[model samples]
Target: MTINDIKNLLNATVVSGHQLLDTEVHNACGSDMMSDVLAFVKDQSVLLTGLVNSQVVRTAEMMDMVCIIFVRGKEPSEEIINLAADRGIVLMKTSLRMFPACGILYQAGLRG
Candidate 1:
């Protein structure tokens, strides 16, 4: 699904890279641990996490992820947003917790 679709699905607020909402994402990885994200994730385009830090953006960049969704209403700082914007990665946040957010996307056909 498109990033726009995921946003709608999760009722997320776009924090950065709004212009790239049309970007398509085939799979998703949900975790707050950047180490697990780096070690276990593969071929995933979207990341759902509660961790609000620049390292999250860096992990997404290294994993070639196109989008990061901050779950549980966590918000990234302006610096983190700027970093993601610079890297051309979409950033969004939702009030939903990680499990429900991941479930919604998975039920909508986005795989892990």
Candidate 2:
């Protein structure tokens, strides 16, 4: 699936990287713990997280995720947004909770 489809599925608001909305995403993992995310690095995928820190972007970069969906309406700081922007990772915010966000994406065909 593409970032655009994910946005529609989750009713997410793109916080950055609008130009990357069409990027392809094949897998997804949801976690708020950066260490746990680091433990499970695979191919290009999407990350669903409620963490609102720059470390989330850093971890996503290390894991090579194409996009990050911040659930629970959590917003990252300016530094975090800049970090994600520099890494070319699309960042979005959603009102849905973490479990529901992950479920919606998985149900829409994003998996790991």
Candidate 3:
């Protein structure tokens, strides 16, 4: 699904890269641990996390992820948003917790 679709599915607010909302993401990974994400995730385009740090954006960039969804209503600082924006990554915030956010996307046909 597109990042726009995921935003609609999760009722997320776009924090950055709004112009790229139409970007397609076939898989997702939900985690707050950058180490776990770096060690295990593969071929995922979207990251759902509660962590709101620059490191999160770095991890997503390194993993070639196109989007990051901050769960539990966590909002990233301007630094983090700028970093993702610089990397051309979409950033979104949602009130839903990690599990439900992931589930909603998965149920909508996004895998992993």
Using lDDT as the measure, the top candidate is 1
Tens digit per residue, CA lDDT, model 1, 47-110 = 9999999999999999999999999999899999999999999999999999999999999999
Q: Give the per-residue lDDT of model 2 (tens digit) for 1-112.
A: 8999999999999999999999888999888898988886677489898989888998888888889999999988899889989999999999999998888888888887
Per-candidate TM-score against the hidden true structure: 0.99, 0.95, 0.99
Candidate 1 residue 11 C-alpha distance from true site, Å = 0.6
Which residue pairs come into collision in candidate 1?
A: none
The per-prediction tally of clashing pairs is: 0, 0, 0
lDDT of 3 by residue, 1-112 (tens): 7999999999999999999999988999999999999999999999999998999999999999999999999979989988899999999999999999999999999999
**Over 4 Å off in model 2, which ranges?**
none
What TM-score does structure 3 among the candidates reach?
0.99
